[model samples]
Target: MPYVNIRITREGATSEQKARLIQGATQLLVEVLGKNPQTTVVVIDEVDTDNWGIGGESVTVRRKRGQ
Candidate 1:
């Protein structure tokens, strides 16, 4: 079994987009690691911008400054 965790900001990502992400991750594991797609686990965690940080600043603040 292969477990993959993907984290992204809650920025209006659509269901179709999320589905594609899960599919793509599973496919990658199958192709590169010889994992079974049926057994692969993919999890996407959408976090609030304020809860995600980078370079000593929150993603919310960085976006405000256009960084």
Candidate 2:
């Protein structure tokens, strides 16, 4: 079984978009790694911008500063 975990900031991504992401990731693994799609597990974790950080600053703060 292949497991893939994708984490993105909670920015109002639609269900269709998220489903496409899961499908794409599964396809890539099946094509490149010869993994079985039936046994593949994909999880999407949506995180708050305030909880994600880069360069010692949170994404929420960075967006506010237009960085």
Per-residue lDDT of candidate 1, residues 23-45 (tens digit): 99999999998999999999999
Candidate 2 clashing pairs, residues 3+ apart or interchain: none
Score candidate 1 by TM-score against the native: 0.96
Report every candidate's CA lDDT. Answer: 0.96, 0.97
The lDDT of model 2 is: 0.97
Please write out the lDDT profile of model 2 over residues 1-67, one tens digit for every residue.
Answer: 9999999999899999999999999999999989999999999999999999999999999999997
Q: What lDDT score goes with residue 57 in model 2?
A: 92
Report the Cα lDDT for candidate 1: 0.96
User: Model 1 off-target regions past 4 Å?
Assistant: none
Q: Model 2: how far is 44 from its true place, Å?
A: 0.3
